[model samples]
Target: MAFVLTSILGNDEAIKILSYKWIWSEEFLNKIPLYLLDDLLRHYNRSTMEEHKLLEILAIIKKDFQKSSENERFRD
Candidate 1:
């Protein structure tokens, strides 16, 4: 789902859609690239969702980022 959205809308726009619509599940969220997640977090203050939900999403994004970074380091 994230892949399709990213392909069709590009990362920035996809993130905007996801953030605004609150349409992302954990699996979908995990599918988004870490860079896009970072972009989302950077602009989170501009989103309309409740602060706690946004913080929860940020935690998931951070966890995914750490896991991806660890995997890359392990592969290297």
Candidate 2:
């Protein structure tokens, strides 16, 4: 997962995703590998790393969060 995350952080998809906001919370940011966030803007658009990048990332994360929430909800 770390490798995949590292690779994606610079990929087109990552760029596309980060090209809008920057709101990386300490919690979510913690889960990412230490190196993933350092040069994110190099791969992603500068717009994505704005302070609001955290918010934009939150938006994108919500989708995955929703999916996992459903699975967890059904687990028990």
Candidate 3:
């Protein structure tokens, strides 16, 4: 968790880590907390350019988070 959390530090570090090569995957993305994930997305949305691959990865992660929250909502 701390390892993943480190990605959130500093301005645009999240975008750099996420947009660069091979630093992330679906399994790795799932390990990140939703709040931190949202924060990462904020940084990404603010700073990233035209990295299509990173956009796709982030979209999938966001969709999964939405699905999980929906499932939890129904369960409660």
Candidate 4:
């Protein structure tokens, strides 16, 4: 999940969505690995050309996370 998020962050749309104050809160940010965060900072520091494609990927990830969260809630 962290890898996917970091990879998607390279896209401008993903960056814009993820950079929101609520979305980029410390709790969510802390879940990412340090190395992934460093790589994202160094490599994905700027937006990429494939913004639409990457945003699609981000949407898929978001859907998966929501499903997983729902499943977890049901289990609890």
TM-score of each: 0.32, 0.28, 0.29, 0.36
Give the Cα lDDT of each candidate.
Answer: 0.51, 0.44, 0.46, 0.48
How high is the lDDT of residue 41 in model 1? Answer: 58
Q: Least accurate stretch of 10 residues (summed lDDT) in model 4?
A: 67-76
Model 1 vs. true fold: TM: 0.32
Candidate numbers sorted by TM-score from highest down: 4, 1, 3, 2
Q: Of the candidates numbered 1 and 2, which has the greater TM-score value?
A: 1
- Residue lDDT tens for model 1, 14-75: 56544532243566456656755675556544654355544565555456544453223222
Q: Which clashing pairs does model 4 show?
A: none
Whole-model lDDT, model 4: 0.48
- Give candidate 1's error at residue 65 in angstroms: 0.6
Flag regions of model 3 displaced more than 4 Å: 1-50, 70-76
Candidate 2 is scored at a TM of 0.28
Best by lDDT: 1
- RMSD versus native structure for model 3: 12.2
Query: Candidate 4 lDDT, tens digit per residue, 1-76?
Result: 3444656455654554444443445665565456544554555545532445445545644654554432232221
Output the TM-score of candidate 4: 0.36
Q: Of models 1 and 3, which has the larger TM-score?
A: 1
